[model samples]
Target: MYQMLVDLTKPKTIRGHVDVVERSDAGTVTSKGKKKKRSRKKNGRTSSGVGSDEKLNQGVDESVDGCTIGKLFVSNRVIAMGSNGTIVFEGTYDGCRVAVKRLVKAVAFEVNLNLRISDNHPNIVRLYGTESDQNFWYLALERCTCSLNDLIQRPTVSEDQAKEVKVPKVMLWTDKGYPSTILVELMRDVVSGLVHLHGLGMFNQDLKPQNVLIFKEGPLRAKLSDLGISKRLVEDKSSLGDHATGKFSIPIPIQIVYCFNPIAQYLISLAVTGCGSSGWQAPLLNELQMRAVDMFSLGCVLFYCMTGGGHPLGDRLECDNNIVKQSKVDLFVVEHIPEAVDLLSCLFNTVAELRPKASEVLNHPLFWDSDTRLWFLHDVSDRLKLEERKANSDILKALESVSSLAFGTKWNRKMGRAFLKHIGKYRQYNYDSVHDLVRVVRNQLNHYSELPLEIQKILGPGNEGFDGYFRSRYPKLLMEVYKVMHQFCREEERLNKYFKGSVV
Candidate 1:
């Protein structure tokens, strides 16, 4: 959807003439005239800070065709541009299409980080090789179709326009925007990438829609790109560790190296003065620990995707102000998807410590199918039946809070007296307590098929019948129940059991 406005004719030359170098096995670049030894300290400092244990290789092996600098080519067509004037151009390497990023008068910090972790997962953009001339540094990376920003911000096509555009089948688009299933899958891809990065002791400090790239080669895949402002957590173990554990009283100062480009200068300013881009930044950006910052930004990104480019905390100009004041989010857009609303509430919670981890997010009920969600609801009802006596427990307290807030109240009335009377013969139904609410839902789901034809039509049919009805009528009931149940279950085991074949 991103407009490629640059002229296709007269492809601009990157460099008229230059000596091509090949990286030999000795950690040095050899040209036709001379051999230059690449500085290990410089490359290491570019990513991991001065004297850090994470060492970066000068270049990848020349044996791989993709890594050979001589086989790379750059065109004039621009793919995208950074805030600091870094230009990404459509290019090729070893006869394979790639994206060539040109940085003027600046070091390639992003490239250093990408080379270190690119091969670890499919959700991360790959780095083919790096090349430099007198004026600019070039990084060849995996080419993606477009960014998440472009995809979500695409204007809704009219009926006639829709007929003309040959959209991919995997992208399920409708007048109301993408379906919940497709949005969940895209968010899962992103969260998986975040989990991988967090496991490696890294934080993508700037995580907005623009940085999330979408690959449409097979199934639609979302990959995390643009690590220009990302931070390595192991750099200052004591400072960052203390911050992570809530020991630091003030925001830690970010270290900045001098760079000539305006883009790098702008990035340095953000690093030294703030967390990330304004609208997508976390509320407690200065105080929250490493991954929490990313999770909050991810919450904003998720909201953007689900709402067809609407921000939860108002528009771009007002978002930062709203976040600073802890203003109530405008969640009406996703009120129809209770599970999504619940997950977003946690991710957007004002208390940074309460936000779910990346791995836990993937395990949320939002990613579960209709059948899995129904099963989960049934399981929660069974557990609540046993634990109802432990009123002081956290799970019960959560349920009580949800009940007091009027979530799923008088459920039998909503089902009509006839439907209630039919199930009333089996057992007594009281909708006053949270336990009763769960029981009512569980009983209704259990006797779905046996219900009268009129009631069956009201509840719909097949697997999603009850779920669709309940989610539309009482948007918070099932999700609140899920939160209560999630607290009681072991996350690792639950994930292995329920999400075995699912999208997490």
Candidate 2:
């Protein structure tokens, strides 16, 4: 694509600067000028509401005209505006949207997005090109509507029904968003976006739910943007060591009822978020495991959107995934609760691979199981109604039965110890001795769910599956193992209470 970094501070044109002119086979360029325009309009400034057509009309004829940077002209509309300090216009370039950003900053560290994009992924925005002059830096980027955090804060969908009449209710960000289709679509898109980034050998150190957006839901397209803090995964000298990096917050509402007496506050802190607006950031995220961190955020997002409620684990107190595992998401988002449940099931897996990858979600099977969706839509509200009146003591009766049946295996093993042993034995293969084995599992686990038929027979099996003899008979055992570790968290809580009282 054609791109240029024209100096906006020019008081004179290219015709006046013979010595500073940069001539190429394509065209002539010059950096010789007073470098400050009399009016902001001349420098590519305009009100936020101003359309691209109006903004383009005020400048030099030699500036970006139509789709062409220097010669081409075509139809592409500017879909978004950048920060207030930058005069930017974005449009479809060769069928893909591209942002043409140019502006002056007093003392901002210059960024070159393209150099790092090859190693970046779909969830992380790509930077294609940049141009610079004495007074300004020009950047051409991929464009999307806005941040995912921006979308969450705007408005959510709620239902209202009155005696034979049903109507759509548009609600501002208060814990939930539109029903099933939107949430599933958002999840699907975000997963695909994440898969793309991981493909480039990069890790999204800041993979919060709000950083994801469903730009095109019907087709299930998501774009991961905002790379100011994104870093490249490579064998290079440049590494991100908190280079002014901050995080975005999910606009889902807060459940302040959680914060009551001091004892309650301690308990509430475990279940609720300390971040503003009960941000969907996972509390354990601060531990820096860097393994399955994004999955934690995705699970939290699913919890909020499906419930139209506040943060999960409201009455609990903990920072680890154990609290997340024990604290269930309470809303029964009727239409797609099953699908939501399934997504959350895979997302919160203690073992990252067993959890669904963002790519696998492109066409989730839950979409095919029409019965589950219908069941949720019909029963969820009734259950909630019963809950509101405190009449739903039996609301989760069937679920409780299922859990009892599921947990019966507890007699066979301790949750965390079994998995720890499983990992120990699994590593015994391909090792000369126990001492040489790397604590890390070989990367093959990434392809666990998507193994080709040729490799499946050897790696995966049934009636307990090959994992029983290899990893573990029931893969879900890992969650149980983590649960065992989570049990110890109460000891920490007890210690915390004692410390809080004793501290002088």
Candidate 3:
């Protein structure tokens, strides 16, 4: 329901001709034809930045296309600006649509460059190349639909406005938008990207919804885009042995240090910008380790997505930084799932040390179900080949999606309660009897479509509507159920053949 005012058909307002400068092959900023000294600022703002002198015009070729120079044809269409005064322009390079991020100050160029180089994941923005002017640095990246914050914060369309359009659930907002399934997928994408980043030796000091971009393609995919305020971890000498292949280990050990690298220190001191908004920023930001800070921000994001775009720390978070530190996340939704509440509890824990690591979170049962466990595989092991790792992760994700669709969490809970009713009656059965019972249940489920009317009548009543709804979706549901039961049969067969009465 969030509407962004992006008119691709409408002519964009082009700013007038501006001088284009190039960067040296060594990556040094140069102005026109001379070596220019880059001015450093605590906040990323330079006096002579790009588009500083000109107003919006219809015709003005900046002529930013050269070798070590710019190669993008920047259009007048303006994307959202960053909190730090960075302007993103919709541009093109070699006929490929791209987003060009223009920064006033080149102070964080090296920092941004390092972070971009280290980042290479599907759920993170892809940086193609970079260009610079006398007072600005432009980063060419893959263009996305909009930032997560923009999408969530957009004004919901009035009922009158949407009277003609048939908006799908994926496109819905207000009281009927962004269900748990979509939220889980978004969370997984973001977490997967963060895990990849954390695997590298860097931490995103600025992890907020504004920094998370949304690609509105087949299904909504979210990507972590900005890393200007990120900090790279300086490896400790003692941890060398843990780096088996000399590659940085994931969930890397980091400690709270008083002094950060020059770039990160500069980012931390900014009053109005850098890092993240107060509510999303972790308490004792500088005192806790980098991962802890990121986890806190992730927690905030999770809270936002789960509650239909509400902030965890409340709207008053902007009034004082102390409020974020003291505020508790109270998930008050009456029908909220306990698993989601448990996840939030871990994220909002006051003690930073007690927070769960990114890897631990991906393996959370909330992300897996019986249907998911059959079709896909979870990658709990990091000791596999690159291709193998990716394969397993993709498979797991596919399985997870199948689970979300076929036996979504809501139905799973309902069915679980219904099954629990027979537990008391079956409690007296032995292991062998229990096995037979499971087989009989599987057989009945397999032929659910063919059950007699009288037999169906005795099956119970609390979920008659639910049962009918699922039966309507019978083919798809039954296919998934059969696939799951097939896996169970295979496992049982293997166990019976090898370990049937034998002690391991």
Candidate 4:
């Protein structure tokens, strides 16, 4: 899939080095610098009269040599069409390829917002420059291979293609869904972008798979795009206050009603309503105009990615209804990935204040690799052992929670008689004691290589060995420990000093 994107975006020389040219009216110019007049219809309107605001040759000119808008030479090939009558074209800015978004009914506010937020951030799409003419506004942005929506909806690779490609060690792409590793990485990127936005006192009101653009460069990178409805947290106080008090208007453009089909118009209306896309929006968005709304939408987006397009609340038709009713989320698809379940649980919390910040979401263990997760668990185990006697209420609660959810009663039964000979009464292990369970796991991890060959086979194979074994069998163990540790650290400031530099 990534290889296909690479092929699609590989630069093609439309025409040899062409100089930038200025034009007073909407018309195409040849590579030799001769202006070609656009054809007009019998009614005096342009031939391609898609909308009243759309100019035939302003941006989407069907010229063999392509047309220049400011410094950008926009190709006639339409990359995408927005319901709001905006057109995105494949274009060249300076020497680099870019996505040229031509907005007929130009919104000056959106242009300024993009310019303000798109600079010096890897995860936010880069804006090269902006241009305008009598009829349209053109924005030259970083060209990504495809949107995350396109990637998510793409068909799985054939057996032949799969056999030809060497999948990465971290990635696990099955016929059922996308690689868990890829989903985590892409989601981390989205969260990173959101952190940047929230840090700058802005919130992306509309965050969905379509708003996340994918760059298939070295590693597949995800960048947040489409900040058309985004708002600055500090500047929009009055509007946000109105939203909180349930006294806000959607601000739908009057032009959109005439241009799009009924279905497209309905979708567009929902999108630009300032409440966010139906399924991805938080339930209390109308009552709470805060950054946490973005987190709820992010959780929905993450759920979609992890489940291969399944929405947590329900299908698209039912999502908004379910959200309004505060219905239970359908989490069956991600049940195996406990970390994801835990993270999503927090993000999906109806209480806006309880939702984690973007930075906290980025630091989740769901994004961590096997080795890092093991190291964290090992560190937590050591801390628990050292602080057992002086453990706080939070620590005790965490310990009790983990013990109740132990992997099994006979945890050491698989280790064989010889392995347990060093320790007394190892036959009937205590599943009720967190200390015993932690000690057993720690010992197995600590002496994995020294364990007998049969015992090692029982644990599982691979470079990760016991880490992978435990992760597959008891995925929630790591999450439970992390929760306890996090709670403990938050309560005990002095104890947090020990984990100042710890990997979360």
Q: What is the TM-score of each candidate against the true structure?
A: 0.67, 0.39, 0.56, 0.72
**Regions of candidate 4 where Cα sits further than 4 Å from its true position:** 1-65, 156-179, 235-246, 249-275, 284-286, 388-398, 413-432, 444-465, 490-504
Q: How many clashes show up in model 2?
A: 15
**Model 3, residue pairs in steric clash:** 14-57
Query: Candidate order by lDDT, highest to lowest?
Result: 4, 1, 3, 2
lDDT of 1 by residue, 1-504 (tens): 123322211123333222222111112221322223333222213222112211111222222221123445554456667866688865555444567787764546444544445435877776666666656667767766556776665556554443232222345343433355666788888888888877777778789898988776456788898876666666533124344543333233422332334333433444553447867766544444757778889888888888878899897667666766678776888876666777788887777767777888877776776787777767677766656677477777777777744364566656666666776788876666676767766877888867789888877787676776665556567666655555555364533365432221
What is the lDDT, from 0 to 100, of the residue 224 in candidate 1? 92
Q: Best candidate, lDDT-wise?
A: 4
Q: Following a full C-alpha superposition, what root-mean-square deviation does model 2 have from the true structure?
A: 19.6
lDDT of 3 by residue, 1-504 (tens): 112222211122223222221111112222332322222121234323223122211122333222222344454446557755787775544334456777776454554555455546888776665656677777766766555665554436554332222222354222322234565777778887787777776677678887887775578778887787765665721111124222222222221221434223323433323455555666643244567768878877876766657776667524234333356767775123444565667866787767776766665434443334222211111111232446455433333445544444434243343343443343432222212222333433444456555444444332333233333332134334333333333245322222121111
Instruction: Write down the lDDT that model 1 would get.
Output: 0.61
Candidate 1 residue pairs that clash: 84-263
Candidate 4 RMSD to the real structure: 10.4
> Each model's C-alpha lDDT?
0.61, 0.37, 0.49, 0.63
Tens digit of per-residue lDDT, candidate 4, span 1-504 = 657544333323334332332121223333322235544332223343223322322333445334555456666667677756788876656544567788874574455454455445889987776656667777777766556776666546554443232222234343434345676678888988998888887888789999898776578778898887777666545236445563444446644662454444334445445447666767654445457789889998888888777789887687776777677776778887777788888888877777887877777777776666766666666766656677475576666667545454445553446545543434454546655656666666787777778777866674355666666556567776776777666346534533342334
Better of 1 and 4 by lDDT: 4
Each model's backbone clash number: 1, 15, 1, 0
Off by over 4 Å in 2: 1-111, 114-128, 133-136, 146-179, 208-210, 214-220, 234-280, 283-287, 308-310, 313-336, 349-356, 359-504
lDDT of 2 by residue, 337-422 (tens): 33445556666655543555445544443332223322222233233334346554443333233332223333224224434444
Error of 1 at 2 (Å): 40
